[model samples]
Target: MRFPFTALPLLALAACTTGPDYRGPETARPATPGAQFARASGDTGPQAPAAAAWWTALNDPVLDTLETRALAANPGVAAAEARMRQARASLRSERANALPSTNASALYVHATVPGLDLNDSGDSDQSGGGSESLNFYNLGFDASWEADLWGGKRRGVEAARAQLDAAQADVADAQVSLTAEIAQAYVHLRDRQQRIALARDALARQREMLRLTEQRHAQGTASALDVERQRHLAEQADAALPPLAAERDGYLNALATLAGEAPGALDGMLAAPSKAIVPLPPAQVAVGDPAELLKRRPDVRAAERRFAAATAKIGVAEAARFPSISFMGLIGIGGTSPGDLVDFDKLAAIAMPRLSWSFLDFGRNAARVGQAEGARDEAAAHYRQAVLDALRDGEDALSRFGNGRLSVASAARSKASADRTAALTRQRFEAGAATRIQLLDAERQSLSAAQSLSQATAAMTADYIALQKALGLGWR
Candidate 1:
């Protein structure tokens, strides 16, 4: 059959699309894509960060295990994945809208007419002689398709696809955040445990010093005030234990929860204090330039995708302003007798072409188009802001990581000096050249220095995790 002349132009315009096309976010693109981060100096090398499991860089097996488990089971990550699946389903639904829909139906009707004569043929006067029973059967198919003359459905599909991309990016962003949080909590747990152990050791030594001071007093060489001073030092050391223990337990519980386990599930594995200190990240870290950061950051990518989706929605809104054309068809076979329903000669069909327009709605379509444009602009602004934030995050993380390295080094040097002083003091005391109280004071300074070192090391590792997160290196 030949196509209708009136529908020729509609088919010709079917390939035409409405509204603006998205080429990339112009506002969000960096002018200097090759610029280096200002803080990427000294300890941070000017190299692209590895896309591997960043937590494994610490070489702590427990941390690696926790990160793997958290990524697999974390509720936040699971929710993001679910949203991604939902977006994918929406995209599929939108694509299906562009195709024709068909439905099959089988209908049977039975009716009884009183005061109707079946044996009277066409004679109307004999109709009340008897009642007639009738049975009708129909087997039919119905199909309808709304032509995408202005590409509205196509635009909808485009928007849905971009939304799916955004959802996938959200999942990646969640993984990055979860990994960083788990690493931070683990570092904190180890830091607290180390501090507690140092405090306990210091308390034991202080108690021993108190006993020595009491003996000296009984030998008529030391004053009662000296014994009281030693006891006060020992008590102070003992008083510092509980808070550290509490903090250690808090971090342990946090790790367990992050791994999708109960609060105390990890207690058996992490509750015991270890003599080992918090592991330090490498001295030099690889931080790429700002250009790479924007591309790698999941939040930035998600924002860009949302902007694209919004841009496509403008097309959808613009297409809504035009008239819509649709075609519907029905094909059926029906007969009063059961055998007649199967006869090909008894078939009936209908074809309907429809047109609908909202041209009389005043400015409603215009207002909808305006609203869509406004949303597009808002998304563009958000995309630009996301780019800025990603850059700032990378720079800030780089600065902190660099400074953290210095802080750790300073603490380590202080610890070494304190240790040397304490060793010399102990020797002097053994040689009868220095007093017992002098050795105790030197040992206390050493313990304090060790604690400071532990804190600095943990902070440095935490900063490293932040830097990895900024680079978006934790997710596959």
Candidate 2:
């Protein structure tokens, strides 16, 4: 307190430190997240502004439950949280280092003189036993404090605080990725379910066609090869199911892992049916410009904090190059008996002021400063790259999402046309206006259209998830 000096206090100057103060990088700030994303608005059905829990837009309670559970219990999230706590503890330790510390200790001593012994008058006795003894007890508190004259301790605290901030951002980053993974896996699982069902339906229809073809072959209108071909088509449809079923199970297992459970633990919940609604993102998403994106993205924030920490470390190294000042004070009372240990009037006090300088070791200290500067520069580069990356991700996600919506519409149209064609072809075959080959070809077209639609829908849903992740909309 009060600069740790009293005599010649007027001669002592205020703490002056040498180091480059960090004013963030001198770069052109990008426009605030654009008023609207380049690919947002107009074509993506009814668009609405995104909320923090973007997955809730899907209107799937199952996904909501999954996201909640994953955020609450996922191992990744827990690990991130643990790291944050550690950073905070480190920061606290660093801050505490700037304060004074005191410790109490007790000392007892007994000694015998070589050729003398003390009598009633404390005089030395010689010749008989020729022994002298002394006993004393001492108890005291020792206190010491280092003056932060060069701000080295302060810089260390600053760095620790920034590190804590970085850890916080890391947790947010984990949540963002975890939520996105859950959404993507959930969408894929739903898509596979729909595809598998369609495949099964197609197989049943092909079986019927095969039976009819056999009847026709017996009646002499269909050849053996035609019946054989129908049988082959049925088998192909049957073959499609296995891969889809495998993929569905894979997604379910992934979901279980995301929720921090063993694989297949979520099977009971997911087994009910793949009715998960993979909703498209709103037509007009409000992703603020590049500035907003940079701040919102946890990785970017983490990078920025790392840069701050590095900058503060430069001050730490620079401070180390200067002289250090420390003060120690001790108070103690001692007597021949332990009962006199608490006598204040007899207490002895000592104070020490230490000044240390490594001025002779300037080269080594300079090298350390150089290392800190290099690390700061590296951290600055990382922060800049993080900003660039955030912008790139947001732009890319928006582009994919917008384009995916258009693709979904086209696929839906193709499926509707296929359905109509299959219906008309069936009626014509029944009336003898179309051959069995024509009906079968129409059914194949319908199957292809259904597959395309399912894929397009899944892609659109995935696009939404990606965009939300890029925007950092969830895990708020």
Candidate 3:
């Protein structure tokens, strides 16, 4: 009987595949707008920084170099990229299952029987022990295809595609995080350097005051006790420098490591005074609605994809419970002699359509479906949590940016007032009108104000960096 190839297409068209249709979960809608951290100032509509290279907006050449190096060398980012490639391969493999498969096989064999035949009958057949050579070769094609009578294969492919997309998002997320971390480290290192310089300056100024008090004592215009107090203040100021220097060194080491170098490797680059302020990108940070974040954030998207995969697995298990039908066929010629392999007498051809359904194992299929559903629920929960975190970080970063600017402003005024008060107190002491204790108090107040100003400046820089990270705008 000849089965025409054209019949296959007609059969496929006549068959109906069964399986659950996939529709993305509707839970992806955005969270409320009011009081959400993603909301920017004014309703001009939430704005993200330009999609092109967010780090470039800072306008720092050094930053550009560091970010480039980190993205290339960071282990976490590299691993994420590798995983994405694997996910894509998996998706492709799943999709390929939706089509028919053809396999070609060839076999060759030689054997000898030295004993009687091993069949049992009322009269046993016996043959004299003899050496005989048997050689046969067969070349055939076998094909098997499950009529996707249900959307099982299609659903599986859909789930895999979603997972592959999620993996790509994860890679993006890793890149975003790496850039933010590099920026944060660089800014902190610069601030430490500035603070170290400020501490040294304070020590020098105190030493000058001490020298002047000694001269007054020598001229009998100031008491010996006043000179001793001034000396003590100078010593206190000098003592603070070593600890600040130690902290500066610690930050330097950290920065070097982040740039993918051995500790102290980047000291040469940072040794020069880096007083040039790192530019802040934008005064305002915008967070689109939480719903938008689900689409934008890679981790959340990855979780959603995992959920979709698990949902499809449930249908896969359900399909396993139904009868599986497949078509198989082989055509070839075989003979004891190699030259006779193609003889008409030795030709053989077979075609089969097999249907298999397990009469037992009812509990196994049900258990598999249960497992898939449970996994899906877990993935959904993780996705929800990711959204909440993104919103929280965005809101928190904006608040810090605003409050940090205020802190720096107030600190500046305090430093200025303390400076003026110190100058006047010193003049009074030189005229012998102010007590030694009063002069000492003014010096301490001046030092305190200077430290406060340094702290505020560092805070302001850090807040801006944080705001950008929270808005998910710095990793483009």
- Prediction 1 global C-alpha lDDT: 0.89
Q: Which predicted model would earn the best lDDT?
A: 1
- The order of the candidates by lDDT, greatest first, is 1, 2, 3
lDDT of 3 by residue, 1-476 (tens): 88799768646733644434557666677545433443354522464344335667667787788888777777888899899899999988998897778888877887755553534442224663444445678767777788665557776787788788788878878877777777777776666666666666667767777887888889999899988888887898788778877877876777667667777987887674646353454554555555655566666677777777777776776677667778888878777667766676777889898878875985987788788778777877877787778777766776777777779889999999999998999999999999665676687678678778867876776777776566555444
lDDT of 2 at 182: 95
TM-score of 3: 0.81
Error of 2 at 237 (Å): 1.6
352, model 3: CA deviation in Å? 2.2
> So what's the TM-score on candidate 1?
0.93
lDDT per residue as tens, model 1, 1-476: 98589877877899899989899977555687777888887677778887659888898888898998999999999999999999999999999999999999998998877787765363334436676777899999999999999989999999999999999999999999999999999999999998988888888789989998999999999999999998888888888998998898889899999999999998887765548569789767888788778888899999999999999999999999999989999999989878877898999999999999999999999999999999999999999999888888888998898888889999999999999999999999999999877898799889999999999999999999999998887877
Q: Is candidate 1 or candidate 3 better by lDDT?
A: 1
Choose 1 or 3, whichever is better by TM-score: 1
Best by TM-score: 1
The CA lDDT of each predicted structure is 0.89, 0.83, 0.71
Judge candidate 2 against the unseen true structure and give its global Cα lDDT, from 0 to 1: 0.83
Worst 10 residues of 1 by lDDT: 119-128
